[model samples]
Target chain A: MKYTVIVKPKKAILDPQGKAIKKVAENYFGKDIGDIRVGKYFEIESSEPKETIEELANKILSNDVTEDYEVIES
Target chain B: MKVAIIRFLGTNCDYDCKYACDVLGIKSEFVWHEETSLKGFDCVILPGGFSYGDYLRSGVLAKFSPIMNAVREFANKGGYVMGICNGFQILTESRLLPGVLLKNNNLRFIHKDVYLKTEGSRCYFLKDSNKNLLKMPIAHGEGNYFCTKEQLEYLKDNDMIVLRYASEDGSVDEDANPNGSVFNIAGICNEKGNVFGLMPHPERAVGHLGIDGEEIWKSLLE
Candidate 1:
């Protein structure tokens, strides 16, 4: 089975890259533009069990202190 | 005492660290990352560089090197271990130290000389120093340090915070914070104080560069 892992900075954490991009986006698309947050997406072609994949996402793909990750079967 | 300077795949400062050791009259050797043993070594220094190309994240992949197990064991056994710049990131990734280093708040790679105030630590590295302020060079993008609220309290209670960014007059404030580190922290030691990590390059500050870090090396050797 293939799995997709999406990692994003935690809500309480500040995303400077996202903020920098958001400023540029606002300059091009009006000041009312929505907030933009940066994140990492990974597609894995592994036959590992769901639990194993989850562990990979939790331990390797994302940092628990600053990032939140979700795994989806696709 | 002999110091073992561990060289990772992308480590560029191993030679610089060795030079510092040599200038200090301390015996040192370059140990490859794959080596599993740290026998006969009194201290270990992890120098700074773009290890593993800073892929995934700074020091993230480097933490999996075969020698980290031995480094962990050595640190756990009351051995002295110090990480500089990228080495600091690896220590945090390896869970040898608390907190994490994120990108600079301004989102830029900052490289310049900064003032550091000794905050007192249990470790011998910075203990009993006459100088309260020292100027050192820092070169890194992900030197912005952060931690949970509870972790900050624990660090304070244990005197784990060893260094903080300060002004020439030794004032630590938000304006003095170049990288937005919590409490303007530039360095920290583990709870036991055997392990320490800092974003500044003390090795780079010695010799021809500057002698501000000479006391740090002298105290560590003492």
Candidate 2:
């Protein structure tokens, strides 16, 4: 089995890297752009159950205080 | 006091910490991350570096090291534990300390000497320090600390905040905040004041690179 996990900074927290990239993107495209948020994507292949994958996403992949994680079974 | 400096893969500051201990006449030794016991050590120091190459996040991977279990047990037993720079990140990641360190507001790695205003009343690590304002070097990209508003209030209410970025005259304000840390926090102690973590490299200061970190390292003495 393979799992995909996506981790992103919480909505309330300021994402400085995303903001910097947004600025450059707007300059290059020369158009008003909506908010740009950056996140991490990870793919894991394991025989572990989905619960274990969720736990990994929650415990190691993302910081609860600053980020959120979603585990997708594949 | 005997100090055990915890060394994780890519931890480059362990030697500097050992040197600091030697200069202070404090017995110190390097304990690899695989060691499972923290026995016979009065203090544990986690020095700064890009542990695990900061793969997932700074200090995130290092938290799973075998030695961390010993560190947690030691800290829970009320033994003195201190984390500096990247070590600070690890403490937070390990949930030994509250909050998290985010990337700098400017999205840049900051390396420089900054003034610190000591503020905690219950920190064992600052008990012997006489200076309220001191200059120390900080080098990190993700040193901007953040926590929920409720947690921040609790930290303030409990006097857990140990240090804040400040001006030379000891005024703490937004201008002095290098990485946009909440309330300009540069260091904090656990609720019991035994476990302390800070973004600045106090060991590097001890009059070697520049400035005297005596206020910090000296306070660890028995």
Candidate 3:
């Protein structure tokens, strides 16, 4: 099965890269943008069992301290 | 006492660490990451560099290397293990130390001399009294340390926090924080004080900078 994983910086943590992009975008978009948060998207193809894939997502693909991840479209 | 400097695939500071060891009169050598045994070694150092190209996250992939299992066992058995810069990130990611190092708040890769103050820390690496404020060089992009509130409290109660960015007056204040680390923390030792990780490279600062970083090296031979 294939899985799409979305990893994002935690809400409490600062995302300076995203903020920099948001600033550049606001110069053109003129205050219409709500928020621009940055994150990582991973498309993984694995034949492992679902539990194992879940473990991979939690253990290897995501960091609990500064990030959150979601497995989508498996 | 002999020291083992574990060299990961992308490590570039192993030689500097080895040099520091030599200048400190301690025998040391490069130990490949694949080696499974840390037997007969009194100290192990995971030196700094862009290990695994800092992929996924700094020190994330390097934490899973074959030798880390042995490193973990060694640390658990009250052995001295230390990580510097990129190695520090690896120690946190590997859960040998608490918290995580995230991108700097200003999103800049800072490389310059910074002041660090140590206070009553029981880490084996620090030999001087708590009053010394050392000027050391730090080079990294992702070094902002964060943790849960309870974890922060636990760290405080146990005196796990060993180093903090300081002002010229030796105060740890918001303006002194270069990387937005919580409480301005630059280094931390494990609960047992055996495993240590820090954003600054003490090995690189030895003998060339303000206060010789040899105070840290002196602990290795003790």
Candidate 4:
């Protein structure tokens, strides 16, 4: 099975890398930039069931304190 | 108080912590991570460094060292314990503290002096401290602290919230939070208030090394 995990920081928490990138984009492309949020994307190949993979995502791959993750079939 | 600094295979700050204790007129010893005895020490410190090359996770591997068994026992007996930077990661991995430190939000190693606000008035380490704002140096790639909202409330209710980051002008500002730590928390004390773990390096702050590191050490002794 092929799966993709998208991990993103929770809204209440600040994203420094996202902020820095936004600053660069605004400076170079003029101030009409749309929303841009930085996150981690992981693509994995595994024989485990989808449920097991989701558990792994919650347990280790994503920090539940300040991050949320969504799994998609690749 | 006699202090013991744990030296794991890759610890680089054991000597620095020893020197800081020496300046405080406290006898400090370096305890090998494999040692099982923590006798004759009132406090034990897990100094900063890339323990186990930060392999699986910062401090994850070091938590299994034999010394940590003794350290945990000592802490359970009401002895003082402190962990800095990588040490903080070890504490969390061992479940001594509440949360884990993820990579910096910026995805880059940050090294700078940041201001921290004292969270309470009774912590033994920060007692009788005049300045509410502390300027300390922080150098790390995995220092973003995270915790559940329930845990955060519990810490606040129990007065475990120790030091929080502040702006250059000593004001609490969300934008000034360096590593995206929730609640702007830079450091936290265990529920007993004896164990403390922080990302900032007070050892690096001592002397005229540019910031008031000596005074901070003195406060702990006081």
Best by lDDT: 2
Clash pairs of candidate 4? B205-B213
Candidate 2: the clashing residue pairs are none
TM-scores vs. true structure, each candidate? 0.98, 0.98, 0.96, 0.77
Model 4, range B1-222, lDDT digits (tens) per residue?
A: 788899998999887787787766867889999999999998888999999999756887898899999999998888888898999988887778888787787788999999888877345567656777788899999998888888989888889888888997878888878877778888888888778888999888865454555545665573
TM-score of chain B of 4: 0.95
Is candidate 3 or 4 superior in lDDT?
3
- In terms of lDDT, the poorest run of 10 residues in model 2 chain B is B207-216
Q: What 10-residue stretch in candidate 1 chain A is worst by lDDT?
A: A28-37
- Give the per-residue lDDT digits (tens) of candidate 2, residues A1-74: 99999999899999988889889989998975878899999999999999999999999999999999999998
User: What's the lDDT for residue B23 in model 2?
Assistant: 79
Global lDDT for candidate 3?
0.87
lDDT of 2 by residue, B156-182 (tens): 999999999999889999999999999
Best of the two (2, 4) by lDDT: 2
Runs of candidate 3 with Cα error greater than 4 angstroms are B128-131
RMSD to true structure for each model, in Å: 1.0, 1.0, 1.3, 4.5
Candidate 1 per-residue lDDT over residues B1-222, each given as its tens digit = 889999998999999898888788888999999999999998989999999999998998989898899999999999999999999999999999899999999999999999999887776688647888999999999999999999999899999998999998899999899999999999999988889999998888788988877867775574
For residues A1-74, what per-residue lDDT tens digits would candidate 3 score against the true structure? 98888899889878888989999888988875867789898888988776776688799988998889888756
For model 4, the stretches where C-alpha displacement exceeds 4 angstroms are A1-74, B219-222
